[model samples]
Target: MTTRIDDTALLIARALIAALFVAGAVQKAVDPGAAQGLLAGLGLPQVLVWPALVFNALAALALLIGVAVRPVAFALAGYCAATSFFHLIPSDPWQMSIFVKNWAIAGGCLALAVAGAGRYVVTRQRKL
Candidate 1:
């Protein structure tokens, strides 16, 4: 059984992760052209722009609803890893900070992916 503190931590982590995805998706969706430019600048194919936006939006929804949490977390983690590699490999001061932040968030996503969310997640409750 999980303790209250554990539950609280999970909730906070979930919300923060969800918020990050939601914000990213919203930003991309709002300006897909910009997102495409970013992807192209990163040397990624322009075709990834729409898919990335859609994936982030869907992942955010999954996290918000605590549905398919592990898969969503895994997907987001992969995305973050790729993004970090693309943006941070150049080693600029700004990109370094973003890289650190992405890695931290990816760590949280990895925890959620492996641990299967937590006591407060819908998946946990649904199991009962």
Candidate 2:
């Protein structure tokens, strides 16, 4: 049985996660040069920025629509974990906060993957 609270929590989680990635995509779209520079600084090839931007946008859209929620959540969780180690993690305490937050976000995604999309999602998982 699905509780009201569970449905609400899942919706909120999906929305928040989608919004974060969408915002990131918008930032990358608005300042491609800066995005490329940042990626290059992290030792990533600048050419990868365009594809990453598209991936973020598409993944955000998928999350928002709640289609293929589990797989998307797992992929985003991995992406977040990777970005935390490469882009966010730093020696300074202030910078470490962002790193910690990325891991927290990844943890949330992992939870979402395990929980599925609840009753509110568009896509329904089949029971075996």
Candidate 3:
């Protein structure tokens, strides 16, 4: 049911979405002290930051390369929504904006989940 432009649009969307995850991973990697402290303050284990770093890096690459995009997008959607809580403090305009953006990203991921990666993926998707 999709046209070529739809597939191309999906490809571009995937890249843009993946870029966000890449930036997140890089930020944590480059500044673990801050990331670790933030997680610790949230009553999460500081050690959890490293695994998160790995997940973000791998997931970003997988999404960017269009590998298992449906599953990855679903997972990322959940991840985005869950992490959004960290920025849910409405008193801070900056945090509120991030929380809203995370929800928007989650919505986009859900769309990708429904649409799949289309034809331009590392593993070509069959028209269904």
2 against 3, candidate with superior lDDT: 3
TM-score of each: 0.83, 0.85, 0.91
lDDT score of residue 112 within candidate 1: 86
Best by TM-score: 3
For residues 46-121, what per-residue lDDT tens digits would candidate 3 score against the true structure? 9988888998899889988889999999999999998888788889999899999999999999999999998787
Tens digits of per-residue lDDT for model 2, 1-128: 66989988898899999999998899888988877876788888998878888989998888888888899999999988877764454567765886788899999999999987887867566999
Best by lDDT: 3
TM-score of 1: 0.83
Give the per-residue lDDT of model 1 (tens digit) for 66-93: 7888888998898898787656656588
In model 2, the runs with Cα more than 4 Å from the true position are 88-94, 123-128
Model 1: how far residue 121 lies from native, Å: 3.6
Winner on lDDT between 1 and 3 is 3
Ranking by lDDT: 3, 2, 1
Candidates in order have lDDT scores of 0.80, 0.85, 0.90
